[model samples]
Target: MRQTWRWFGPKDLTSIDDITQAGAEGVVSALHHVPNGVVWTKEEIAKRHSEISTRKDGSASGLTWDVVESLPVTEDMKKQKGDWREHIANYKISMRNLADSGIETICYNFMPVLDWTRTDLRWQVAHGGSCMRFDIADFAAFDIHILKRPGAPADFTNAIADEAGRRFEAMSEDDKKQLARNVTMGLPGSTESMSLEDVQAHLNEYGAISRDQLRQHFIHFLEEVVPTAEDLGLRLCCHPDDPPFALLGLPRIMSTAEDYKYILDAVDSPANGMTFCTGSLGARPDNDLPAIVEQFAEKIHFLHLRNVKRDNDDIMGSFYEAEHLGGDTDMVAVIAAVIKEERRRKAAGRKDWQIPMRPDHGQDILDDLGRRAQPGYPTIGRMKGLAELRGVFTALEHGAFGLK
Candidate 1:
């Protein structure tokens, strides 16, 4: 496994020096300042490469931008609407520029409107630490009472609806407004910032689109872009939906393992791959983490190894981010499966044997309580996760899992 860290940009509170201190071998970042539909010029790509390799005093940092966390697939491209063809052309050009600049992995997603929805940004855990949480009742309150979507009532059970009603009544005016902002945080550097009214308008537009339609749209997208990626020697990894379930009546086609197999089969190319995110897929109890890892190990190009403790028995359960080894996921088993896959790849003499992974999210503990870094990208929190995961890899390779 190749250890990497997700860095926002030059303006990020956590600097490249900080990533170096964490012992990460590479940096995962994007040209966040550029708009969604715009083409990333070779000059722009080279400038970011220069920044990652050089320091403030113009000396060498020895770190390279190995993977792009995303290359921002816009709404028009997903829906095949206004300027969709033009956007596809631009996306291919960006892939060529990135390949020419020596970056191989690019991660993206097909989620509409929101990137990741969380009802509470700071939900206190049993310990003194706080983690990002998604509460079903609070989300229901926002959907039914706050956002007032057309069919919000039919999605959840009667019990969930009743609880949501009570929660909304208990919340003060300030709490409701803040809850609205938290859910719409979207991508880190999205070109368009939306409001509550804008969210409703977007949902209204998707009323006619079903889950099957969305899946077809995504396949249509890959049909155009995957060939370009294969030609450019780039591996395009699609990130799973954050919660891996339907929310606010939007279709979530890329949530389950079956969804991944369907898309990979549709594009049937070496360039098309999956970003195996344990945190999102683990939010559902039915998703067996280790089994899923081995089942699609060949297609997984990037990894996001974080755990979440689910609250309810159903698919739409509430979940909160947990410490690296403290969560319900069997971290040791998951890492063992990853190791087994790498050994298999090495025996086959594949060039891309070592997979790139980063600690996804962490609890706000100790010094990270008041940090200026992005929420979930805290320096101390992620360093702790990286150390814990590295220990897992070390132990497994040294006979802990009998690999030695």
Candidate 2:
């Protein structure tokens, strides 16, 4: 397994120097300033590459832009509306440019309007530490009362609806506004921030689209772009849905293992791949992380190794970002499975075997308290997560448990 860090840009509180200090081997980043569906030029790509590797003093930082967290697929591309064909062509051009720049892995998602939704951006935890949480009641309150999304009431059960109603009734005006803002915060460190009105418009745009139609749209997208990635020896890895379930009546197609199987089989190429995000897939109770890793070992090009503590036993419940080893996932077992897959790949003599794994979000703690960092992305907190993950990896690689 290869270690990487996700850096937003020069504007992020954590700099490339900080990432180097954290002991990460590579950087996962994107050109966030550029608008969606616009072709990323070779000049811009080379500029970001230099920014990742070169220092102010003309020294080498020993880091490269190894993986793109996303090359954003525009709202129009997903909906196939208004210049989507042009957007698809632009996406192809961007992929070719990125490959020419030597970045092999590309991550993207198809979760309609919102990239990732949470009801609380900074829910207080023990010892004054905080992390993001997805409270079902709070989300239902936002959907049923705040955004007033049509058919949202019917989407929730009667008991959930009643609780959401009470939650909405009990909130102050400011609290209601804050809930709306937090839930629709969209992808952090990106250009696509949405408002409550924007949410309504997007939901209206996807009004009658079902799961089948959305999956077909994704397949069509792959049909157009996956071949380009294949010809260029690029890995087009799709990230699973954040919550891995439907929300606000929007169709969620890429949220499950079977969903991935459908897409991989549809394209049947190594270039068409998956970003095995344990935190996102572990949100669903049925998504066994180790088994999924073992089964999809051939196609997983990148890994986001984080865990979440589920509030309920069911799939559709609340969850919070837990410590690296303290959530529903068996961290050691998952790492073991990953190591096993790497060994198998090495035995088979596959060139692209070292999967780039990053220590994803962490709970706020210690000096991370007052930094006001990007919601879940605290400086010391993520360093702590990286340390813990490195410990597990060391134990596994050194044969601490006899597997190695």
**TM-scores across all candidates?**
0.97, 0.97
Q: Tell me, what's the RMSD of every candidate? A: 1.5, 1.3
User: Which portions of model 2 show Cα errors greater than 4 Å?
Assistant: 56-58, 399-401
Q: Between which residue pairs do clashes occur in model 1?
A: none
lDDT of each: 0.87, 0.89
Q: Count the backbone clashes (under 3 Å) in each candidate.
A: 0, 0
Tens-digit per-residue lDDT, 117-208, candidate 2? 88888888876899999999899999999888878899888899999999999999999989988887876465335788888888898997
Native-structure RMSD, model 1: 1.5
What does the lDDT come to for candidate 2?
0.89
